[model samples]
Target: MRDRAEITIVGAGPAGLTCAIGLALAGKKVVVREWHGDVGHRFHDDLQGLENWTDPVDVLDELAAIGIAARFDHHGVSEGVVFDGQAKPHRVRGKRPLFYLLRRGNAIGSLDRALLDQAVKAGVEVRFNDRVTETAGDMILAAGPRRADIIAAGRVFDTDMEDGAWLAIGSELAPKGYAYLLTHNGRGTVASCMFSGFRDQASHVAATLAFFERHAGLRMQNPRPFGGFGNIRLPRTAMQGECPVVGEHAGFQDALAGFGLRYAVRSGRLAAESLINSTSYTDAWRRALQPGLRTGVVNRFLFNAAGQSGLDWLIERLARNEAGDTLAQAYRPSLPKRVLFPLAHHRFRAPLIDPSCNHENCDCVWCEHGDHSAAIAGA
Candidate 1:
């Protein structure tokens, strides 16, 4: 089915749908093409959450400020237990909600489904199972993550838990990333995100299960296994031949933790604003999000390099403060302290040195201007 509109968005995820809604409300005809049957089809019973410390305001409030009135409950998470593979369970508690949890599925209440509803209400036309390779008119590529920087093995199960979250860090469970168990309303999702140890993934998953069982006292039945990939590289250019990429495809993910829903929503709205106001998408995103994202990449590199011992050291350092305030400050996006001067002092270290990367993924040296390679390589 061939059609034309003022704007054509690919992949009906948070970013694409948000863009559609914004453009539609502005009286522009918008069409969205989805490869899957419905919204949130890419995920199963995965329990995802958005970070709150980075932004000055709450994530839900930020969404509301952008006129996104999705009717979904944001489960506030105020406290959690962290384990550094050995130390007695370190309990971190905050005065306010540290994050908000949501399910990832096509259910009526899922975040993706909620966004779709809002988009439709704004007169955005959505075509399901209409995988598109090429398109005409102003284009927005809101496709999900591009490459697998960290592969996650997840499981959804019926558990007798009383609603809580637990994060564990150790070489045996997850190499560079962390393993988390989130339970709510008698259901739970447990996953091991691996950064370097891809070959021993199964073993890592098994070890995570065992560790949680012993430490968290997790009781479950009928555990179903699933997996997905996460990409955390920044894009060199926001435009691909006049098309702007949004969501995780633009590397708008948090480097310290894999929280990106806020970034997805923010980028989508920014993309739509650019299209309507005849502004530069790249400049807009750079002004709003580039600093935080670049800081995240540096944090990711340092965390990976530190390995298990370094991770333990960092956590212990955070534990020095009783109220978990230091930890929050460490994770929050601070341009002057965390990024600029730190990078200048340390010579701007990164995980990848080469400027050339697959253009589709956009996590290249050219995109971030990381080092020497970007001088010759163009994105």
Candidate 2:
């Protein structure tokens, strides 16, 4: 931190950057340190979503409430197709956007670049290609995931096809999770997000591609393979010593579908508010995010316990309530989900790992500290 800065934040990802922007805007001099050469170093041009349907309010309005403007290039996906185990396609539409599509990278038009621009404009000093081992003083840690609880085999390619979003469900396609194909303009991305069988991902990826081709009349050119992972956990605390940890570093991710951008932004804002108001970050975030996170755990647990036929039945039911408002209610926490939470929490939360090298994927802090980075698009 500089002589005038009141706080230092580690990592330049969304959470840390959001916090820096907030603190800086509040007239508190803030500095952000990033280990990578620039923001979004862990990602390439991979597509990610800012889920909009889980909350009762419109996601855009919700974001405005927290002071994060939608300044990045994004497409609102209000309609899409979902395929069940038997390869039967169902049309799913939302009254509002189900999720906003975003590009994750350092390039212009990406979400990372948008936040980086906002932070710089707010007078937040950002030091790239920097690292600090110590976790002390008025510091916040937003250093991404520590492990891969779910890995994805993804590809980005050029296509002549029209804009569309498609999701497929089946063991052959994506073990316990799901496979997705999203396209806008002329660019396309395909990924099989799997929770198990990491070693046999090649076959899973191939099968997913073939399935989409057969069903959606997909086409591609200059296809490049990239990969990523989701680190989902309901943390017991969001503090490291006296500092607050935000985003994936604190395991603040959606337990059901691995949608995390919403959680990341909200947690970052709460962390900044706590610092600004001299309140407790842990208490603040838990009140805001805990219910939905616990609901996600229960949802995933039920989805897991459901067999093939049960999954088919679920697909039928979900398709009927595809609109954002109708679907959001289904995800709302309930007594049944609450009753199952203790068990789900126990079963779903991943164990913490020591920061010891486990693979030679990348030399970033995450990989050096034992988290394996997958080969991503353009990596």
Candidate 3:
């Protein structure tokens, strides 16, 4: 690693790698460090692990801006089917690609090679197998759950899937997310899905297998099962300083939906721009993700009001069928002030609540002073 660089990014995931590529493209000296020695190693063994790996066109555009684009041999389905345990299954179709499933290794390998190649071409230094023990200056932390320690060390603390295998039947078995069984170059099939916090993940897995067996009317003695988890974080305040945090580190994930790759790419570009142009990081972040944040607030409200069943109903009805066109329309850049004001109301209420209600002698001035004479004396 260079002793001193204009920027040092930790974690070589999509977010960090994208940022590094963007910054280097802008002619800034950059160094990136990853704890893992080899890029895309963890995913090498599980090539066909992801289900519904849809590539949003906007994400592709952003990647292209940084000189990296996803290469997939298969076309993605725009329609997704949802089984709600009642009535006929629902199908959602839209203009956007619903979700695309690919081998994790392929996605990671393409991105890793693209990022490193661009960084080297642009004269950016990269360090692998080097864990960041300490951070200072303009450092970006995109370590995801691994950053739990860094979060704990800070003072301001506003805290905070599986499926299987038959093509049609297995898809029905999984809830909310997509299920896929893909054979890589005619080798073997890898089946998986996104769980969406279902109460019984194992049961969902079993149900998917059963659906495959019943629908396909065929069964191997023992079908292989593989599963994994994806996540999105709530909107959170900026950390201790002026340096901007991007991607999962800054809580840009949609808590309602686990789709974060688009957001990650957008946020990474926004951060790079902020650094290069010397713009206010907070302003840039807000401008970058305002729509998603608004949507997230609405999602949280609905989830709290109706719970999973309600969410399932809405998602099945709205999100799945029109593909994600309804969502795309809802998330348009020109969101009505009337619609957004309510979401702002929801997001701002926590700071407005009186802490004294939860604990006596709260520091808030609204709390009544117990003794008038003592209060006057102290004043």
| Candidate 3 error regions (>4 Å) | 1-4, 41-57, 71-74, 100-102, 106-114, 146-204, 215-227, 303-321, 330-379
Answer with 1 or 3, whichever has the higher lDDT: 1
Which is better, 2 or 3, measured by lDDT?
A: 2
lDDT digits (tens) for residues 86-185 of candidate 2? 8999888887789999999899999999999989999989998787777656888887876776667768889999999999988898878899999998
Report per-prediction Cα RMSD to one decimal: 6.5, 4.7, 12.2
lDDT of 1 by residue, 22-104 (tens): 88988889999887789886577578877777766877888887778748755889788888858468877766678888877
Q: Record all residue pairs in model 2 with backbone atoms less than 3 Å apart, i.e. clashing.
A: 226-376, 226-377, 227-375, 227-376
TM-score-superior candidate, 2 or 3: 2
Give a tens-digit lDDT track for model 3, residues 248-352: 666565543445566676777777777888776567777667666666556544444564466467656664446465666544444463475476445533422
Q: Which ten residues in a row are the worst by lDDT in model 3?
A: 149-158
lDDT of each prediction vs. the true structure? 0.74, 0.80, 0.49
Instruction: Count clashing residue pairs per candidate.
Output: 1, 4, 10
Ten contiguous residues with the weakest lDDT in model 1: 370-379
Screening candidate 3 with a backbone cut-off below 3 angstroms (N, C-alpha, C), the clashing residue pairs are 47-103, 52-100, 53-100, 54-100, 92-320, 92-321, 93-321, 93-322, 93-323, 161-195
Instruction: Report the alpha-carbon TM-score of model 2 versus the true structure.
Output: 0.91
The CA lDDT at 343 in model 2 is: 91
Model 1, stretches more than 4 Å misplaced? 1-5, 320-324, 332-379
Global lDDT of model 1: 0.74
| Candidate 2 Cα errors over 4 Å, as ranges | 1-4, 349-379
Model 3: how far is 24 from its true place, Å? 1.0
